[model samples]
Target: MNWKKPITSSLKSLSLSIALVCAGTYIAHAETVGEPEKEELKFGFIKLTDMAPIAIAYENGYFEDEGLYVTIEAQANWKVLLNGVIDGTLDGAHMLAGQPIAATMGYGTKAHIITPFSMDLNGNAITVSNDIWKKMKPNIPKMADGRPVHPIKADSLKPVIESLASEGKPFKMGMVFPVSTHNYELRYWLAAGGIHPGYYAPHKGDNSGQIDAQALLSVTPPPQMPSTMEAGTIHGYCVGEPWNQQAVFKGIGVPVVTDYEIWKNNPEKVFGITAAFAEKYPNTTIRLTRALIRAAKWLDDNSNANRPAAVKILSQSNYVGADYDVIANSMTGTFEYEKGDKRAVPDFNVFFRYNATYPYYSDAIWYLTQMRRWGQISDDKSDQWYKDLAAKVYRPDIYAKAAQSLIDDKLIPANEFPDFTKENGFKAPQQHFIDDIVYDGNQPNAYLEKFKLGLKKGDKL
Candidate 1:
C-alpha cells in the first residue's frame, strides 16, 4: 500500500545531504559498503506486539536510511509466514526462534532458514480461562492484599487439572506452534509443576505431542487464542502480547504468568531469511539488519519513552491490529495478570536492551535443547550436533557487520553491543528458569540431563 514513498523521499534526501558533508571523512567507508542488491523487500510477520521492530523500522525511516524500500505485511499465521519465506513469497519474516532451527533439522518443513536478528524477548504469557482461574485461585497462596502472588507457579494449577481429569475431562491448552517459544514455555511450566505436557515421537509417527499427557497441548494461532478459549474449545493458551491482554480485556481469561517469570529475558522471535537470500544479497542482508538494529534501539530508547507512540503504530489495522490499551498494557512496561491487577514489568517486552536483537547461538541451542527434551528431536545426538546446528541457523556474523557499520557511522555506541572481537555467541550460565535449573549453552546435553521430565540421555519415546 505504498508504505515506502512518503518517508523515503524526505529521509533519503536528508541522508544524502549528510553523506555529502562527511564525504571526505566517510567516503572510503561508504564506498566499501555497496548499495543493496535487492532494495525493495517484502517481510512477513504475525500480528503480535513483538513485531514492532519491523513496524518501527518501516515507520521510522530506518529502512530508507539504508537505501532500501521495504514492505511489511502481517501473515495469517506462523506457518503461513514461514512458508512465505520458504516459497520466496516473503523475503523474510519475524519468526519463532525455533522455526529456523527446526526447519534446518528437518522437524517440519525442510529449509535452510537462518536468523541475523532477534526481534524481542519475554513478551509471551500463559492465560487460563476465567473458570479455570476460579478453580485455581483457592489452591494458590495469597498475599496480605488478597492478590495472588507474583510469578505464580503452575503448581497451583495441578490440583485443578487433577479435578478435571477425575471428571474424565481432558485439560486442554493451546500454544501457537510446535516449535514456538510459547510451546516450549508452556511445556516447561507444566513439567515443572509435574504435569506432563506430552511429547512428539516423530520417529514413531505421532507428531500430535500428546503422548502420556496430563494436560493436552494443541496449537492455536496467536490471534485466535482468546476467541478459541472463549468458545470453550480450550481452557488456556500461551501466546504473545495483546492476545493475552485481549483475554484479560474481554473478561474471558486471566494471564497467570509471563514468560519472563518462566525464564527471565528468554529470546522469543527472530528475523529470518533463506540461506540463499543471505548468500545472494549479502549487502541487502546487512542493510536490513542495520535498519532493524536501529529500530530496536529506538524502541528501547529513553527508558521506553517512545513506547506509547510505537503502540499507536502497532494498533493500526495493518500491524498488530489490537486495541491500543491492550497492546499498551504489556508493551508499555507493565502486564495485567488478573483484571485491574496490573504491575510494573519493565522488561516485559524487551526490544534492544540486554542485547535483545543480537542473534545468539546459545539462544538457538536452548530451543534445540527444548526440542530434544520434548522428543521433537526424537533421539540423542552428540553435543557437537546441537552446537553445529545452532551455528548454522543463528548468524551473528551478519548481525555483527550491521552493528559495526552503525557504530562506525557514530549512529550507536560500541558499548551498546557485545565486544565482537572477544565475544563468543554463548551466554553465561542462565539460572532464572522456573525450575531453577542452570543452563550453560556450551553444555546442551548436560542441561538436558537436569530436567526431571521429558526424554533424557538414552531415553526414547
Candidate 2:
C-alpha cells in the first residue's frame, strides 16, 4: 500500500486548483518521508475534547494508513502526560500549548520538547460556581430578552471578589496546569477586569503563581474541575470541554465565558514529542504528523458535519469518557453557557480550519509573551531571543513536509494548508483579544508593551 491510500473524506474530491499557501520563515521540505522507522507507537492525552485529533486519527484508520500502529492512553493529568513523552513512555501526546515552550525554556521540566502539529483551537471556557454566578448575574448587563449579554467580562465578578476579600477570605480559582493555556487565559480574563491574578518568580523558586495576587489560581485535573468547585474548594476555573459543559449538566456551575470570548480563535492544545524522537526517527515523525493533519481536517470538513460522529467516539470509555450529551453539548458547533443559554459558536472546537494545525512561530511566541508577562520568565530579554526560542521549539519545517506529502497523494488539497512558499511563520497583526489589544508576532516586544497589567520591559518581580 502507498501513502496515497484513499481513506475516504468529504474533501477527497476537492480540486488541486484550490491551492496551499500561508507558511512561514523556517525549514522547507527536504524530501518526501520513507517508511516509518518506528512502526508501533503510543500517544498520551488528558481527558479533554481537544485531544480529539489523536482519537480521530486512531479511529479513522489514518494511523494504519501510514503503516503505523498507535496505542492511545489517557493520562492522570497534564504533568503525567508530559512526563510520559519525556521518558519515552509515549511517542507523542496531546499537550497544553505552553508545555513545549515552557519545557524547552526550562520553566518546570527541562527537556527539549517540540510540536510538529497543533491539535485544536478555542475549546476552553471559564466556569464559576452557581453561588458565584448568582452574585455575578446582577452585575452583568442583560439583553432585551432578559438573557445576560454574551462575552461576560470578569468585571462583573469584581464585586464578589471584593466582598470575599472584605471577609478576609481569598478568591481562589483553578487551572489545569501552571503552564497551561487555561492558566494564561484565566489570568488574562481576570486581569482584564482589574483583578490581579498574580505571578510566578521561578528564578526565586516561587512556582506558586500567587505572589501579590487578588485571585489565587491553582491546578486541578480537567475531570476534577466541577467536583472541586462544587465542594467549594475553588470559586471558579478555566478549563477545556467537555468539563465545562459537564458542570452545566450537573447543575453545579455556570460557564461564565468561553476562551473564544476571551480571545477569538486562540491556539489551544498541541501534539508534542521529544525533539530527540523527531531527529532519530524522522520518517515516523512525519508519518504521525500526516495522520493528525488528516484527522484535524476531517473534524472541520463540511461545516462540522462530522462532529456528531466524533462526539460519539469521544464519549467512549477509552477516550474523553464524558457522557455523550455532555460532550455533544459543545462538540456539535454550539456551546451552552447557562444551561438554557446555548448559542451557535461554529468555531468553538476548531480542528483544522483557519490553519489551526500549523505550528506557527507566532503562536509559540504568544505563550512566551504570557510567560514573561506573568513573571515566569522574570527577566528582560531581547525581541530576537523571543523569536529565536519560538523557532527552536515550533517545527513548522516538519509540518510543511507532512502537509506537502498529503497534497502530493491527493489525500488533501493544497489550499487546505498554509502556503509554505510565502508564509513567514508569524500571523499578521491579530486583534481578537477581549481587551482589544493587537498582537503582531513579528514584534513580540511591542505587543507585550500594549498590556498595562502584565510584565513588559523594565518591570521585574
Candidate 3:
C-alpha cells in the first residue's frame, strides 16, 4: 500500500511507547523513599546491669533490624550522661526514671528531656557498710536460724543514726543521684522508719537536700558505692546491680533490702532523649522504641530463659564489667545480701513482665511525689500539675504505638502488655511499699499528707 508512510508511523508509535516506559521507570525510581530521618545513633549508659535492655537491643541485632546503627557508650556518671543527651552529643541514653522529670522540671540540669521507654524495675538495694550492718543487725528480727531478718527495714538502722547523731557525727548515706530511684527508695525506707532524710529547697538556695536532716543523704557513683562505704565515706548506700552484689563479694558491706522489697515492681532506669531529638526524628524515635520493646520482651520471655546469656553479655569488660557470678547474683532471678544470704527474688530485675517498659503517668507522678517529699520540688505544685506533667512527659500513647507494632509483627503477644484500650496511665492503687502505706498515684497530694515526714500541701521551704 504505502510502505514508507506506514513504516514511518509505526516507528513513531514504537518510539513513543519506549519513551513512556522510560518515563514510568524514572518516576518509580524518583518516588522511592529514603531511610527514616536519622539512622546512626549513639546511646549512653552506666555500667550497671539494669542498663540491660539497651545492651540487649544493641547486641542482639534488634537495632540493626530496625536499620539503626547504634553505639553504646558507658558514661562516667549520670550527670555527664544526661548532659550528653541534652547537648545532642549523644542521641539517647539509659537514665533514672526521675532524670527526665527533674530535668524537665528544672531541678538539676534543666533540659526538656523525656522518655517513651521505662527500662526495667527493681534492680536496686539498700546496703549498709559492714560495721553499720553489724550494729543494725541486732534490731532486725531474727529468723528461725538466727540470721538477721530479710528485707530489713529502716527502723533497724534508726538506733545507729541516733547514736551517730548523739556522738555529734553525721550519719551519711549515699544515693547515686539526687533525682535517682535510689534516692527516693532510700528516703522512703528511712522515713518509713522515722529517720528524716533532710529536705531540698531550691527556692531557699539549698538544693543540697540536707536541710533539717536526721540522716544526711548524699551522692556517690554506683560502682564506687562499695568502696566508698569501705573507706568510711558513707555508712550505707542505695544503688543498682551488680554493685550491691559486688559489696557481698568484697565482704565490705551487706545489702539490707532491695528496692523490690521497698516497693514491688517499681520503675527503675529509663531510656531517655531530649524532646528536641525526638521531635527532629520522629520515625527514628519510634523505630528505636520498637527495638527496645523487643529487647525487653526478649529479656522476660519464657520466664527469663535468656538472662543467663544476658548476664554473660553484661559481664564482658565492655558492658557492666562485673564478674559473671556478681551479675548473675541478681540477674538470674535471685539476689545476695550478705555473702551466703542468697534469697529468691524473682522480680529483682524485671525487664518486661508487669509492663516494666511502659512509661506510665502514675509512675512519673510517684517519682514527682518523692521529689516533693524530699524537697527537690521547692514550690507547692497543685495535684493537677503533677498529673499534667506526668501525662506530658510519660507518653503512654507513644509506648502503645511501639508495643502494638510489635504485636502486629508477631514479635510479641497481646497478653504480654497491659490492655492499651482501657489503660488510663494510672496503676491500680499500689500497696507494695515496705511501710505498707497505700500509694494511689491519682491522689498525690493526699499521699504526701499520709507521710509524717516530707513536704506537704501548701508547705514551702
lDDT of 1: 0.91
Error of 1 at 95 (Å): 0.4
Instruction: Report the C-alpha lDDT of model 3 over 1-461, residue by residue, as the tens digit.
Output: 00011111133355664784687521111011223478778899999998888888877767765657777889999999999998898999999999999889888778888899999998899988899988998898989987777678889889998998889999999999999999999999999899999998887788888999898999999989988999999988999999988989999999999998899889999999988887888777887898898889899989899999999999988788899999999999998878798888889999998899999899999999999888888777888999988876787887887777777777778998999999999999999888889999889988999989988888887
| lDDT for each residue of candidate 1 in 1-461, tens digit (9 for 90 to 100) | 32584223344455666875587322213233667788889999999999999999888877877777788888888999999999999999999989999999999889999999999989999999999999999978899999998788989999999999999999999999999999999999999999999989999889999999999999998999999999999999999989999998999999999999999999999999999999999998998898899889999999999999999999999998899998999999999999999999999999999999998989999999999999999889898999999999999999998888888888889999999998899999999989999999999999999888989999998
For model 2, residues 264-327, the per-residue Cα lDDT tens digits are 9999999999999999999889989999999999999899999999999999888888999999
Highest TM-score model number: 1
Q: TM-scores of all models?
A: 0.95, 0.93, 0.92
Model 1 reaches what TM-score against the true structure?
0.95
The model with the greater TM-score, 1 or 3, is 1
Pairwise lDDT winner, candidates 1 and 3: 1
Q: Judge candidate 1 at residue 318 and give its lDDT.
A: 93
